[model samples]
Target: MQRQFFRYNAKSFPKCYRELATSSSIFLIFTAAIAGCTNSSLATKQQPATTQLFSPQTHLASQPPRCQTAQLSVSKVSTNAGAGNVAVIYAFTNKGSSPCNLYGYPGFALLDSKDRPLKGVKVIRSQGTYFSKQQSPRQVTLAPNGQASFEIAYNQVRDVGQSCPTSEKIQITPPNAYHHFTLPEQINPCTGQVRVTSVQPGIIQ
Candidate 1:
């Protein structure tokens, strides 16, 4: 004789057990949804940074206006020479009502009496010379009617016959300025080279 076991049936399961299984399925789906939303939020935070285009006008707008060529007037204040070298100090006065600054060196060229540039003449920017003290390039502020100065040195030795080349006039373009001005001067350079200093507080002595 054999003994038998009981048969399985879903309808015979407890009511609380069925309700608990359905609740677990719903909880899993809700957790998955919350995880997806968190991942999306993190991805948004990891996006690339924003980029901006370079703007010259916007950059310049934040700075003070440059010293205009028209607002400056240059005058030779003193002159000295030694060892076949000559140096002259020029003062630049601010004619405008507003204050401004001069930076770096001035572009200059020796010109003949006929208003033409001389040949082989070169201008080199320098900090100092034997007759002048060395000065670094810096912002030289000028108040209304205030002044700054610079130094120009050149050789006056013999070149071809009696002297090198000479000029009675020079064209000067101030640093950071577009327009140029002319000045009457007497210069005799045998080496065809000129060394100039940056604009400073006062005339070099």
Candidate 2:
């Protein structure tokens, strides 16, 4: 009697009811696939934004432009003459209309009276008490017509038989700069080395 009752119920069910159960399973599967596709699309859209948030290029893009040689003017302001040694402040003025940044040490090369490059002389960088005691290179932003300075100190007297040549003109390249300017002044590197300080924001002692 139980087997007969089960067969009667199965035979009496409508065809649409069976189709509804099958379609319900298919609807659930399609819904899950659609959700997964939406999640994948969101991740793809967010990946580039995440990479750009931490990229170094993004940081560099926000910094001020580097100073160029043509935008600067170099001059000799004054010098502190001591016993057999002198400290000179070379001032750099930003002559351009736009602002720029300067950091690190300026490149110094010796020149003869005729403004020719003199090789073999080393320009030594110093961290003496004459300048600010910053251990690291500090970025100096210069507005139009603003000034910055660096110092060069060396002995005026050299030991006998040592070669200490006199420089008539000095070529100075600002920090991280490819271009240079020439200062028409005389300097003597007694030990073949001129002690230079990094570029400071203003005129330093």
Candidate 2: where are CA atoms >4 Å away?
1-61, 129-135, 160-163
TM-score of each candidate structure, all chains considered together: 0.71, 0.67
Scored by TM-score, the top model is 1
**Candidate RMSDs in order:** 6.8, 8.4
Stretch of 10 with least lDDT, candidate 1: 156-165
Predicted structure 1: lDDT: 0.86
As a whole number from 0 to 100, the lDDT of residue 86 in candidate 1 is 92
Please list the C-alpha lDDT of all candidates, in the order they appear: 0.86, 0.81
In the range 32-92, model 2's lDDT, one tens digit per residue, is: 9999999999988885533435679878877879889889998887788767777888888
The TM-score obtained by model 2 is 0.67
